[model samples]
Target chain A: MKKLSFAALAGLLATPSAAFAQEAGGIDQAVNEVFAAVTGPFVNLIFAPLPGTSFPWIVLWLVVAASIFTLYFGFIQFRAFKHAIQLVKGDYSDPKDAGEVSHFQALATALSGTVGLGNIAGVAVAVGIGGPGATFWMILAGLLGMASKFTECTLGVKYRNEYPDGTVSGGPMYYISKGFIERKVPGGKIMAILFSIFCILGALGGGNMFQANQAHAQISGILGDYPGWITGVIFAGVVFAVIVGGIKSIARVTEKVVPFMGVLYVVAALVIIAANYQQIGWAFGQIFEGAFTGLGIAGGFVGALIQGFKRAAFSNEAGVGSAAIAHSAVRTKEPITEGFVSLLEPFIDTVVICTMTALVITISGQLMVDPATGNYLMDGNMIQTVGGTSGVALTSAAFASAFSWFPYVLAIAVVLFAFSTMISWSYYGLKAWTYLFGESKRAELTFKVVFCVFVVIGAAASLGPVIDFSDAAIFAMAVVNIAALYVLMPIVKKELNSYLSRLKSGEIKRFKG
Target chain B: MTTSIVVGLDGDGSGMRALDFAKKLAKGMGTCELILVYVIEWSPYSFQTAEENAVRHKRREEEIEAALERVVTPSVAALKKEGFSARGIVRHGDVADLLNTVAVEEGADQIVVARSSEGGFVKRVFGTATANLVMHATVPVTVVG
Candidate 1:
């Protein structure tokens, strides 16, 4: 049976390129075509426009939910923002009784997970297609999305399964099931199962595939056009080693390195912005004007809003329930504390870091603006730029315009970002996988192997379909997760109220300033 | 005047040398109260994965309980048996900060610690907790080598 399966695998790998050699780009092209076809319906269904409007319903779905959460919680994201900072500062932490993870560490881990290609490539896509107008909407979405993160993450910790050992299992899947049971709502199990399935798909698509695809794109942009499959193979090998081979040292190295890269990327962007200091006011004018009138861009203001919300959702993963999994690891007895801490994730991921990218892109003048129309010139659905590139390429071009050596640094940062994001998402997907298949070693190994395989496929495949599918899968998680949150929000409110009252009453002590 | 002295422990047996030194100082001063402090070196800025984060609180509880059982409680009892007033404190944070905080909280007039044998290249460059405490502590500090 093993030999037969091995032969089948060998045939599967060899036949694609051989059979489709005449097709442009061989196996990569073939795989992309097949994947696009398979994933098209789901993507369309998820992104399908509202009647007589170009705006996708899923973006509206997420935006509306975030707004509702903001209202429902009375803007806890703002009210508790200072306290959240304090928690992360370890001000409220018991020094003698520290948790396995400090609030700061949890926040940092979740930030690292969310702040990657989505900020780099995804923001470039948003600004490229939607113009600078998207940056305005992106910041708004990020602000509102904080409430969504707060709600989902609170539920995550509240409903997490603490085993006999110190380890835990939590996320949308757990909360969908356990929360419903607590609320006496039926179909919790079914919804949880569905959420898990979507989560796994999302992890494979956005978390692994999107990251690998962009990393390869950035590398190939620099190293010259080679088959993405080669890049895929190397990334998959390294990812497999870290996740499967128990090479925690690699994970540790990445954890340390990615943050440094993040700092460097920000610094480089700041340098560009600082160099173009006089254009700062003009950039703001363009953003505000473009946001309202769309500056004659396609879909105008709506187009800008859609792109902003979509990229923000994709970048921050706020309402998508992925941050819930990461935030659940925080060592706080009061689940609301983690919730408060989590609200900062979107603020940092989208509002701060993403805005930095957008500002640099805006200030760089890589995006061509129409002098007569006071609009951005569009070519084939993307802003007509110097090289007509999009995603990380556009970002690279923007940076390279300022400093020729920056792209080399960006390439390294992109790879590190991609690697760290993939590592984080693998864990998220694994939790969801174990939730569905049970926590057996075989079930886990199966999921990890499949995850690694998708890394190669993600790298090899073209960007459009991979991005479409990635967005669809991640938004699908939001659909299920937001529905669950709508029901479970009262619970979060109760936890929040209780925590606040205790703080007021001095029941919750501040251990440090 | 019932002088109080804070003695820092490294959680290992190495702290006994500092305790012995503080005891002699207390004997010379007369009517000195000893506060045994065991600090678990920690910094909030350190990175950890989700799995590591999950087990951290549990591990912390175990470390505190073990320190109390295997070190602090016994030493406190032994000091009391020797006709001296002694209490132990165990905490998780930056060693120097927490020790200084504990000393201030306990109204200690002196702080005493053994020279850390764990000194390496990094420690030498960054300075050890003993060095930090000696440099920054408001009270007198004694480093027993």
Candidate 2:
């Protein structure tokens, strides 16, 4: 599985820049073409249905699915909130434990992985295309997503293994196979192998290439004719230095970078909001108004609940097994302790950051428009199509509108966000790779070498539909991943109950400082 | 050539635990000075304008020092009793940066800090500070659990 992800990432990055050139007039014009081709079809699909039809089936189904997970767990995410606080508090500190890193570092590392261009660029796309209404459902989806994260991270911890040397390894592949293994169920190992394949593909397509490509686009556009291929090569090298060091170093770096980037991005959004403070009332009105009323036609609403749910799922990654791959490495013995802290991820990524971006774009009121195509823009007056879940450029334009330096600041932010994400996901893919191949030092180094090559490839390539198909392999991971979570939800329940009982019994008290 | 391997220590008064660990290494080697680091967490008390309140607020450090005397000073006295040369010194502000600077200044062989408890004000201090030392420090760190 890990090998395939690396292969796909390398393939995406290897595509010739001549393919990207298109003899195009400017970098924006070329990159924008890719954006239109990807997002256009989705916008048409969402708006195509006849008027007065009830919300799309996806909307109903997602809401129901999210609600079931939320209620069945009795909002375990909320109850675990205090435990999450204490998890960092050292109520359960075990430095002698088997893991490669500590609980807090693992959480920060996972955040650095998931909270990327999605929060900055993707949120703007959601509001730009889906309209303000999408924000409503985005929050709703995020609310339920907390439940999804809780379920997956718990499974990740339960199924984790410690090598004789104290290195820790666990994720969906292990949980799916091992959970059923204990039950003496057949096909569990086969299922585990399939999930590993999906994970490796996801990490390469989404975690590495997709990130590198976006980072390339942002930097190259800002710099202009600065030899983009060289820029890409440098990015891969920087990523390599961190990747070769393994999880402890990656964790060490992200624990500092994630909070710095997240807070910085939020502060930028606040500046935009303050610049257009008077228009805030109308922005809120448009959001609630567009969410229900459809902006596609005179009457059609833009995002509806379905678009909101889909985009939110893409943003926070609650159900996906990726974050679980990270939380599993934490040092504590109580799986639930990490699980509690893990829940905070979705809130920060989606509910907080997404909301900030949505408010910023909505307030600016310029309306997203595709200049040449007129596809994403409405009557050429507003956006005809929102960039397919990548809105960094549009958000950049909005920030630049308010402050002269914002575009450059945002460009740097995007690159740093992308860099942190690529390194962390490399760890995730390596674990899955180890599951398929034996865990020899040689095998690990091979994966890292191949992974580094892909970083360069993703940056230089055109990032066409071929890469998009591979990207689907990443999202497709959730289908197999959530299934594994289901069979293993019982173990998750036992762990949570056990941890809670300990907390209440005072067995897990604050270290007598 | 003698390598000046300084045994470095730093924390709040609670850092006595680190001092104990530092003492062991200094005694074992018999060739280094023991530097006890005290990072006085800045508070409103530090700014108390009245002499009494100022003293009371300043007392937090003194109180911490008194506690340190119980934990760290005795080690210094015991080392002197054993006829080995050692000294305990203090510095303040941003525990991680302070530790790093002292490590370089002392040309320390190793740094010893207590494994932070998972709760309270100490969490932020030790968690980030230790992480900083890991990334930026010149010497090896032995975090006593």
Candidate 3:
């Protein structure tokens, strides 16, 4: 779920650029066309809809895996929700513990990685295309996604490689390989390699490109028409400064600033929702009505479901396994604790934050609803907008209608979100790169340079094929990761049960009352 | 009866003054035990990047070791050499809270801290450890300025 905001932005950006590509002439344009042509077959295969259905099979694959995990874990997301909060609150964290950071810090860092543009622009994309009904499916997907996160993160900690120097590394790559070998499953090594390759690509595609692309979009949207490559070059330079220059000051500033931005965005959305208190019920009615009946919208309820689930999955990334890498660094004796901590991620990212964006968009009176049929007026296939905008711009318009200065604030937030996501993903990609090659200074530098270069390419190019390939690369990770989870779930169940029994017997101590 | 007193240290002149004041009070009381403690200010809620978080545990351990060697150990040896019952502990957390916790856990008779002279906007807003300990500690708090 590499900020579905960028993926959706790319999707929307692709439409206008596709219409104008012939009129535009440049090396970058030519490169984008060729890249799209070469990767189109692969992207289509990964995202291809099921037979006789408009839904993408990859979406179905993720939804089904999450559903199965929810059932298999006895809906542990719900059952252990309170326990998860307690863990995050430091109730179970001993000050004398051996881990690097507290559960709260780990949760915060992981939250930073997941809760970005996905909640902002991605929600806009879902509600725009899928209608208000997409909000409902998005909430359901988030609920089910908690279980998928639980399973993968537990295995991540269990199979992590703890170094002698007290550093550790783990993710789908480690667990898939080691868990498979332990269970006597063949092709574990090959599967791990495959997952690593996909992860590196994902880190480049969704993590780097999509972020750079959308950051440029949001900036240009505010600053008037300008070449995207210029924005791309500036962004790439800053990113290179952070990742390559090893500038601790930049990380520290962003570490403080990004969370503030997240809060600012949420507060802005809440204020908008509160101002339109009367339309609250009407908007919800549209969400519920559009969810089941589709309200004369295209593809009916199915369209809403696909858009909702896709956006939710892409936003929170429960089954995606990239989060497992981040969660694995948490210090805990029981791996199940990290798993429990992880379930809160989708809830915070999708259920709470994304819903705020959906409500703001729905209540802002941007999407024209017909007074007679009570259906949304459609422009071509999209919900017709009063501002005649789409993607992140539509969201900005909705918020700006309320605050009048939200676009400026949102632009800053989007850039910060993109930079933070890029930095986090760079670490994730570097881990995969080192796993494939050996861990060395040269290897790390090589990945960083290439990653920054892609950031430029991502911003410079039109988003058509870049978005497609990014979506495919990220989903490809889930394809390998979920398959590994299906096999290794019993181990998690055993861990969960043992931990519960110990808690019941008073063996698992709580540091705080 | 031997009384126990917890003295908070900041590894500076103020800390040594606090130690001196505690020693004088302990000597006056006869056969007192001095528990010297130094806390490296930290909060679990502070935001950190993945790379920062990954190294935090090691950094914390290093911090504790450095505090023990550079501050607590020397203070303990000096006190003990002067015929005082002194032991040192180094930890990572908010100074006031940790001092109170240590005092409560040790069943100390009183807490002693040096009033920090570095007063500024941040310190004034957040409040100094001496002010907080004086207000919140269950045991008696003596601020030696």
Candidate 4:
């Protein structure tokens, strides 16, 4: 059996390029065609362009939910921002809490999951298409997304099932199913099943494949072209080792690597930004102008708004319900405390880190813009580029303009970011898998093996439609998650009010200042 | 007639050496009990995010479990097998401070510790836990190398 399987694998590897030569179209194209044919309709439905515009309703769904959460909680993201910092600092934490991990580890793990290629490549894409004005909308979206993060994470902790072994199982699935029962709402079980299915798909696509694909891109871009299967196998092996050990192992690596990579990326941006201190005011001016007047792009204000909101939603994943799974594992008796801590995830991931990327790209002057018509120029071409010329290449070019050797560093950061993200998403996917298939050892092993296999497929295949389907699956989670949040916001409010009152009354003891 | 001696276990070979010395010393002192203390140095002051803090509880539990399974229980059981009265404890905090506190709380006549070989720059710069224990312990301290 082993010899046969090995022979089959060897044949598969050896034939890919030869097959490409013979077919003229290649395996990537064939796979993409098949994926598009099979999954394109559902992807289109989820990401259908709004009437009279290119923007998807899913973006609007996230934006609307975030805005409602921000208002419904009375702008708790702003009001509790200081306390959120303190909560992360463990000022109100007791070491005796019933959860598996600490608030800081949970936040770090979640941040590692969200703050990957999106912050680096996605920001560049948004700015390239939507212009400098997109930065303003992106920042606004990040601010509002914090409230959404707070709502979902609090529900994650409140409704989580703590097993006898002290491990926790939570997320939108738990909250949607259990929270509905508590509130006497209907069809929670069905919604939870739907959410679980989407979450698993999202974990495989965005969390696993997207990361592996991008990491391969960055690595190959630096090391010169090699078969992507090589990168896929190596990444899959490393990810399997870390993820198989469970959240603890993933957390250990992320806690260290996430901070290091975040600092490295931010400091590089800061150095470049500082070097262009003279252009700082001018950049902000462009951002404000482009945001309002549409920078002469066809979409104008609405276009910038859509790009900004879409990228921010995609980057920080505030309303997508993925981070809630990571945060739900935090050791806290008061579920509200985790909510306070989670609000900082979007702020750190989007507001702070992504904004830095945008500023660096803008200040570097890599993106050629025509002053008269407010259009980006590529060889005197009025480029109506959306996802084109955006991504790691753009970000790398922007950084390379400032520091010649920065592309190398950016490549390293991308790989690390991709790795940490994959590990975190592995846990997220596993939790959803267990939620569907009972939490047995065999079930867990099967899901993990499949997840690792997807890593290889992601790296090996040029799967545009697969990526689109996965991205759609990720946003699909937001649809169901936001619906549940709308129903459960009142419960979060009650927890918030009670926690605040007790906190104000000194009922919540401060363990350390 | 009863006396208690605090033995600080570092969960290493040297810690077993100190435990042997404490057992021998307790045998000389009539009706004495050896209090085996394993200190897991934990600082709550580091700047950490909520995600790091979430795992702190599990880590602390794991640390205690490891100390008991790999350090305290084995040492205590070995001494008890040799016919000495011994009890074990695992704690988290500043190693020296916690050791001193345990000595004072248990009414230990003296504190025994293995002399750590982590000297040179670390010793001159930060000072070893054994040195700090000897200097700050309320009761008399014996360093067994």
By DockQ, the best candidate is 3
Q: Which parts of model 2 have CA positions greater than 4 angstroms off?
A: A1-65, A89-100, A245-255, A295-302, A368-377, A380-390, B1-145
Query: What TM-score goes with each of the models?
Result: 0.89, 0.70, 0.93, 0.87
Cα-lDDT of candidate 3: 0.86
The superposed Cα distance between candidate 4 and the true structure at residue A426, in angstroms, equals 1.2
Compose the digit string of candidate 3's lDDT tens values, residues B23-139: 999999998999999988888888777767666666777888899999999999999999999999887788888899999999899999998866889787988778888888888
Worst window of 10 by summed lDDT in candidate 1 chain A? A1-10
Evaluation by lDDT, superior candidate among 3 and 4: 3
Q: List runs of model 4 lying over 4 Å from the truth.
A: A1-26, A95-100, A245-255, A369-389, B1-6, B20-35, B40-66, B74-86, B92-112, B117-144
- Give RMSD to native, each candidate: 3.8, 12.3, 4.8, 4.8
What are the lDDT figures for the candidates, one per model?
0.85, 0.66, 0.86, 0.83
Q: Highest TM-score among the candidates is held by which one?
A: 3
TM-score of candidate 2 on Cα atoms, chains taken together: 0.70
Q: Rank the candidates by TM-score, best first.
A: 3, 1, 4, 2
By lDDT, rank the candidates, best first: 3, 1, 4, 2
lDDT of 1 at B37: 89
lDDT of 2 by residue, B87-145 (tens): 66554345666676677877777788776545777666656566666777777887776
CA lDDT, candidate 2, residue A249: 54
Predicted complexes: DockQ each: 0.49, 0.04, 0.53, 0.24
Per-residue lDDT over A1-513 for candidate 2, one digit per residue giving the tens place of the 0 to 100 score:
334433544444545666645532344344445554654564444324445653443334334555766787789867777767666544566422211244555666677777888888877766665666778878878878888888888778777876654456878888888888876667788887887776776677688878888888888787775545676789877777666653345444544665776788798889889878898887777667667775452224544465577677888878778888887766566777777888888887888888888887777655653447422355422354333223677787666667778788788788888887787777778888889997878887888887877776667665554356445556556666766666777777787777778878988765523
TM-score of 1: 0.89
